[model samples]
Target: MVSFTELNQQNDTITELSNVLCHLIDERSVCDLKVTCDLFFSYVDQVKEHLDLEERELYQSMLLHSDQNIRNTANKFLSGSGEIKRVFGQYLKRWSKNKELRINDHDQFVKDTREMFQLVFNRIEDEVEHLYPTVRAVQAAMPK
Candidate 1:
């Protein structure tokens, strides 16, 4: 079971990585594009790992909670995971195809990179503000 502190640290790492990748995207260099794609994929992998942990350790337990409110919240968050994964998968496909991005793709790449950063930032904020607190509450209420 991952501790809450550790999870927050992971979030910080991901956010920092995303920022760096976004800056790289703005550089518009083929070499930077390659680095950006690499970092983006790394970000995706980290997100997947984080989500997997949440699903297993946090959401699953919340879903099984005796409290209906807890179950509902967990379900709501879990519901969004699929769409998030889908979007990330699409981005992965697009980036993976152009390990070395073409000049024509530069505009599209910048747009996609910004959009991805926003998506991740929003999700992380939601989790930090809402989901993490809920999870901590549930865990605290659990009989130790």
Candidate 2:
């Protein structure tokens, strides 16, 4: 099982990344925009990879190999996450074409982007708060 400290560290890293993304969009620095976009995309990919392992491996194991109640709860949580994931895809599309966007489009994009960040932050916090504790509990029960 992963340690709580490790999970907390990951949470902090993600928060920092999200903050930087928000700052980039708000500042709209044409100079470093390309570099920022590349970095943001790389960070997003890494974060998604980490989440995939959690959802597919950890969540799957919990749902299939654990109690029915836990599975049911996890499913409920997953429904909310699915909505957030859809929003995230939209947010990514907006960011990818950000350079091509007109000045008039910038305000709306920034607004939407901020909302996206909030959604992501809330979803991640919820998952880490709820899912990790359950994962730790289940891990404790299993024999090495």
Candidate 3:
């Protein structure tokens, strides 16, 4: 069972990692630093795991909901997740290959990374603002 509390915490963790990674990039030449690299990969894994869990568990309630609006909401978020995954995958391939960071251009890496982080932040906000409320409603209407 993926509790809302746990899901929210996962969001918080990803948000924190994003913030930290963004700041870490600011220190210049931090990209090849082992600690920074590890943190970056950790952030990537955290996001993938969080999205997988949401699709596998959280969204099911919304999808099976009796209300058409709730089902529509689920579909919207599901589509958004697919887009995020696709974009995020491209980001990974662009920056890291064979689990290694290949920074041919540091400035471009920073720019793209910040954009990627914002993409994730936007998705998190949408989940919190739209999806979670719908899920709560679905759960509330269920007979415990």
- Judged by lDDT, which candidate is best? 3
lDDT ranking of the models? 3, 1, 2
Question: Which stretches in model 1 have alpha-carbon errors above 4 Å?
Answer: 30-34, 98-104
For model 2, where is the 10-residue window of minimal lDDT? 95-104
Clashes within 3 Å, all models in order: 0, 0, 0
Report the C-alpha displacement of residue 140, candidate 3, in angstroms: 0.4
Q: What tens digits encode model 2's per-residue C-alpha lDDT throughout 1-144?
A: 456676567667777887877777777554145676675665566566556556665666677765987787578666765776677676666555553333346778688767766876886788677877777877788888
| C-alpha lDDT score of every prediction, in listed order | 0.79, 0.67, 0.90
Off by over 4 Å in 2: 1-7, 30-32, 97-104
Check candidate 2 and list the clashing pairs. Answer: none
Question: What is the total number of backbone clashes in candidate 3?
Answer: 0
**lDDT digits (tens) for residues 1-144 of candidate 1:** 779898898899889988887777676664344565577667877888887778888887898999999899899888777778889878767765544333458778789878987887888899999999999998889889
What does the lDDT come to for candidate 1? 0.79
Which one wins on TM-score? 3
lDDT of 3 by residue, 4-92 (tens): 99999999999999999998987678888888888999999999999999899977778887789999999998998899899989998
List the lowest-lDDT window of 10 residues for candidate 1: 95-104
